[model samples]
Target: MTALRIALLGAESTGKSTLAQALHETLPVLTGLRVARVDEYLREWCDREGRTPRADEQRAIVEEQERRADALAVGHDVLIADTTGLMPALYSEYLFADTSLAAPAHHAHRRYHLSLLMATDLPWVADGMRDGPHAQAPVDRLLRRWLREGGHAFVVVQGQGPQRLEQALNAITPLLKDRAAALPPTSPSTVGKPASGGLFSRLLDRQARLPGSTRWTCELCDDPACEHALKSALPPATPRVP
Candidate 1:
């Protein structure tokens, strides 16, 4: 029972936090897996910094989030991180601006076992702490970057509340099931090498065994012109959580 690190990522006002909370509630009942949000880490970082963070401080925030995610992944059976506005690919663009900062140092994407990408289909809301109106385009760009980087993610589009919930469940349930099947069935463990075979070998086996129909596909705009239109569609962004 290795811990599954699920990361909820997207641009500002895309409902990452709400979806994380909902998944935190629903996933355990359906799969007996726990979910922890990254907000707890962000709140602690804000307290240490003495104020809410600004956009320029994104790299620092992401670093801290990664650290917290690592720590939680160590303790929990399953951890779901509510990412900052930027996805891991976009975060790398900012963190590795200086060539001296080698690629391995900013390996945020490597931390997660699964990523839930909230799509920008709903109206952009200016929540008191949210920073931008041009969130949709950046979100779209980031989603493309995630796909290009070979990251595993699913899009969640805006819809009626229940529909959005079901969409989220549908997107992640199979992943959870697959991960569960891969586990040793003895005790909760970290998501790394298994006792008999290493992580890489297990990963390759999974890929080799994947059903052809389990491939990625976009649920939004049917237009063939959409870049990465073959990538998996995300679940809709839900409202902000209280």
Candidate 2:
């Protein structure tokens, strides 16, 4: 199975690390597969160096983020990344007026199946490494712009702590089921092709054609939203009962 790589992203202190860990721990139990994680390398760099990265260091940060995420994805059903290179690249541009490191970050962003954008609505907490409390808003804007312009499928995670975790799980349900359906035993005879609306909709269309396909995708059907989204995404002729 192609591991589902989900990025928890946004400005600093938006709980990307917290949510990444939560999902990393919870998802495996839900999917019955090992879940792995790659956290923010730039923060590790900053902690080690005792200072924010210089322009020259930005490339290394972005590159390392990609390398770390790719490395952990092996032999796992899912890889939860705290942040992609896009964070450092976005920060480089927003904080240091640097753009050179962004291209590679954009490339890495494409590798993620979904990005859970941490909403900047929560109260900002100071972690000595963050630029300043005021820095989050503008950076949040840039992150949203990047996701939008990049055409990546993303959902903003709101609420606090556990509520936030639940939202992330909700957003990922379709993907988890899709990944399950994609595992071995799947063949040209059972798989479906792309259709309208989006990836989820297309997958549902294909899923409708195969017997027992619902068994693969319905593991998370207890959640009304997941159940409804799956059925709604399917073609009208194949309306599935939850």
- Among all candidates shown, the one with the greatest lDDT: 2
Q: Which stretches of candidate 2 lie over 4 Å from their true place?
A: 185-242
TM-score between model 2 and native: 0.75
Per-candidate TM equals 0.64, 0.75
In model 1, the worst 10-residue window by lDDT is 233-242
Give the per-residue lDDT digits (tens) of candidate 2, residues 1-242.
55689888888788888898888887755555568899899889988999998887888888988898888887777889999999889888987898887777888788888888776657888878787778877887787777767777666666678767766766676777777667654333124433334224433444455344222234332222342354333211111122
Give the clashing residue pairs of candidate 1, or none: 154-234, 155-233, 155-234, 155-235, 156-234, 156-235, 156-236, 157-235, 157-236, 158-236
Residues 205-230, model 1: lDDT tens digits:
54345444433343433222342342
